[model samples]
Target chain A: MFLQQIINGLTVGGVYALIALGYTMVYGILELINFAHGEIYMIGAYLGIIFLGIFTTAGLTQYSLPLSLFLTVVLSVLFCSAYGFTVEKLAYKPLRNAPRLNPLISAIGVSIFLQNYVMLTQGATDKVFPHVLPVTTIEFSGITMTSLQIIIIVVSLLLMAGLHLFIMKTRTGKAMRAVAQDKVMASLLGIDIDRIISVTFIIGSGLAAVAGLMVAMYYGLVNYSIGYIAGIKAFTAAVLGGIGSVPGAMIGGFVLGLIESLGAGYLSSEYKDAYAFIVLILILMVKPTGLLGKSEGHKP
Target chain B: MLKLENIHTSYGHIEAVRGTNLEIRKGEIVSLIGSNGAGKSTTLMTISGILRPVKGKVIFEGREIQGLSPHKIVSMGVSQVPEGRRIFPKLTVRENLEMGAYLKGKGQRAKGKGSGVKGQEARGKGEDTSRGDSRIALAEQLDHIFNLFPVLKERQKQLGGTLSGGEQQMLAIGRALMSGPELLLLDEPSLGLAPIIVIKIFKTIRELNAGGLTILLVEQNAKAALRLAHRGYVIESGRVTREGIGKELLDDPAIKRAYLGE
Candidate 1:
């Protein structure tokens, strides 16, 4: 039971981490929470579902599972990135030099606007995700595992690894780091601050979309309101790890996922969300900067 | 060469730099000396593209740069070691230096100027491989800086925020050097430092100038700034009150009484 719970926790944690990366990256550079980010994740899942439905209706099933998944991931990421870019250009960029709280409010406004818009367009009902994935069970040494669980874990790990590499090893990644450290200084060093910020949104939103698609596939359904709870949970994970820390978000996601899974398994499924909240509160009480956050000392 | 003509900058309603004019020839260390709130920093900020002038023409290397973004100005080979030594607190000294070389690295890679295959690209150019390479090159240029301030080489691994104020200043200047800038804009290098440290920093500034780096320095220490600079401009309330050779200004009775405390 413990091992099973661990697996389940890891799967959920992976999804949270993916979504949390977007929030953390955007916040790291802009110092804004980007409340609309969660909705962007929801949009990703809906986009994937729409693409899958189209493919199925068009009778293109001869494509292998891997190929279909690849196509879905590509299309979903592109769509979400564009969505995120437009959000920044239209909503946030105009208020760049405005007061901090102004952007925060605008972000919330965007979030609510996206949520209601999705509801009106897609309808309130949860659309069923087609179970196209093969469900072969693999049993080894009394540990039974489904292909879905394994695939989710593997894909999540791969995506996280890719993100890590991109941030640490690329020029654009370095630029992002530079901007995060000091926007003015970064600009003085010849980094196009606007371009770096745009790229940051794109990357963050792209990862969120992937998480959304995965969550929809694993759960077999997605709804417009899915962003609310999932967004909160992922944000909780982001805060748990460290608000602006990338690795912190990953750690926070897994911890939250583990806590929720174990709480659901041993205590009560009804209190699963309560477990996450409890962890968040406990973490905040102990280490307000999150697990991996650096305490930024005040400069007099 | 850099020139600023009739530059006017404001902070909201209050005009900070009121039609300031200044010029620095190649290979010269020109100092702008003033009392606090005299708009010395504003002039440097305007030149470095941090603050846009409300009215003025800033020409650098024969191109107008008054309205250009800070980063674009940097790409044109102008870099600033800003006030308060704004180094990335979390990043290691090395990482901070790498960011300085961001644009130069791209230019180098685009032109294929250096070694082929065994060059910067071979050094594990990560995400912005080309950009990273330039930054790495920028880091390599630090040997010159380290030669000037050997203490930085000793504490290269330390987080920038952890350094002493003087050490932080050195790191800031060192980081700026990594960018291989043609014109270095320094804002108050002597703001908060011991007299001995101030002397050492000024001496290093002189050495850098001797080595052919053009510098536009804003300083509160009028005596020391004038001593080191080839030429001097006295700015009062954001306008040039006087300008002349450094020694001429230093000997001026009015400058000596008001600024030099003679």
Candidate 2:
């Protein structure tokens, strides 16, 4: 039972880690808590449903489930990337130089706008994601695993690894880091600051789109409001790991996932949501910088 | 190679550079000497397209580049080592140098038109192996910088923030050099360094100038700047108050009293 819970915890943690990456990366570059990022993830979920619905209606799902799923992911990622880019351009770009508080408020406004926009258009009710992925169980050493669980963990791992390599080995990634460190200096070195910020949004949103698809598949349901709870939980995960640190988000996400899952299973399933916050508060009290975060210190 | 004609730059309602005119000839080190808030950095910022002048033209190599973006200006071969040695602190020495060569890498990918690479591809770095030429060029530049400041080579793996102030300044200049700039704008390279280190930096600047690289230097150390410069301009209250050949400005009694600490 304990081992089975670990598997379940890992599956959920992988999704949280994916969503938390969007929050952490945006915050890393802009120093603003992109309150609307959760909305982007929520939008990703809706886009996945909408696209998968189209594929089903067109009879593509009858041809091959994998191909249909692939097309759906690709379309959702593209749309989510566009949404992320447009949000930065419309909502955040104009306020780049404004006082810190102004952008924070603007972000909140964007969050509300996106949530309402989805609710008004897609309706406030829970939307059913098309049932396409085959449900098969794999039992090993008294633990049962679903193919979907393996798929979720594999997809999340691939995306994170790809992101890590991109940030470490690519010129654009280095430029992003440079911009994060010092905007003016990065500009002087020929890095287009605005473009880098846009790229951040696109990447973050793309990852969220994949996570949205996985979650929809796992639970077989999604709602406009799902982004709020998931976003707050992922954000708590970000803070728990380290708000601006990429690795921190990954670690924080899994940690929160495990804590919540184990707490719900062993103690009380009624207070599953509270476990994340409880651990977050405890971690913050002990190591405010989060697990992988560097402590703020005086510059020489 | 660069000229700022009757430029006026401002921060909101308050103008910082009011009708400032300056010129730098090819292969000459022209130093702009002034006190703090006298528009020294503002003029450089304007030249680099970091600050768009409210009025007037910035002509570089006879092209009007006043309204260009900062990256556009950098691609055009004008790079600035900004004030305070603003090296990316968290980046390692090698990574910082790699960032300096960012435009060079972009320039290559942009040339392959049929590959659908936008001059600014925002998705991620492409898998194209077309970086061969730029990669070689980057290595040459890195070697040049390491040779110029051997200590940087030794500390190539260290994070930029861990470097001492003098070493950071050297890294800043090296990073700028990696951009392969024609006209380099350095703002207060001598700021917050020991005298010996300052002299060494000045020596490197003189060496670079000797190699035929044109430079526009802004300095509060008027005497050293004038001595190294081919010509000098003393800016005060947002305008060029005095202009002369290096020694001519160095020996002027008024310049001595106002800036030379008579």
Please give the RMSD to the true structure for each candidate, in Å. 4.8, 5.6
Model 2 reaches what TM-score against the true structure? 0.93
Per-residue lDDT of model 2, residues A1-300, tens digit only: 798888889999999999999999998999888888888888888898898898889998898777888888999999999998998999899999899898899988999999999999999899998777779999999999999999998888888899999998899898988987888889999899999999999999999989988898899998988888899899988989898899999988888888888888899999999988887788788988888888866332
lDDT of 1 by residue, A101-208 (tens): 999999999999999999999999999887777789887766677787788788878888898888877777877887898888888777889999999999999999
TM-score for each predicted model, relative to the true structure? 0.91, 0.93
State in Å the error of residue A243, model 2. 0.7
Model 1 Cα shift for residue B58 (angstroms): 1.6
Give the number of the best model, judged by DockQ: 2
TM-score between predicted and true chain B, model 2:
0.90
How does residue B213 of candidate 2 score in lDDT?
72
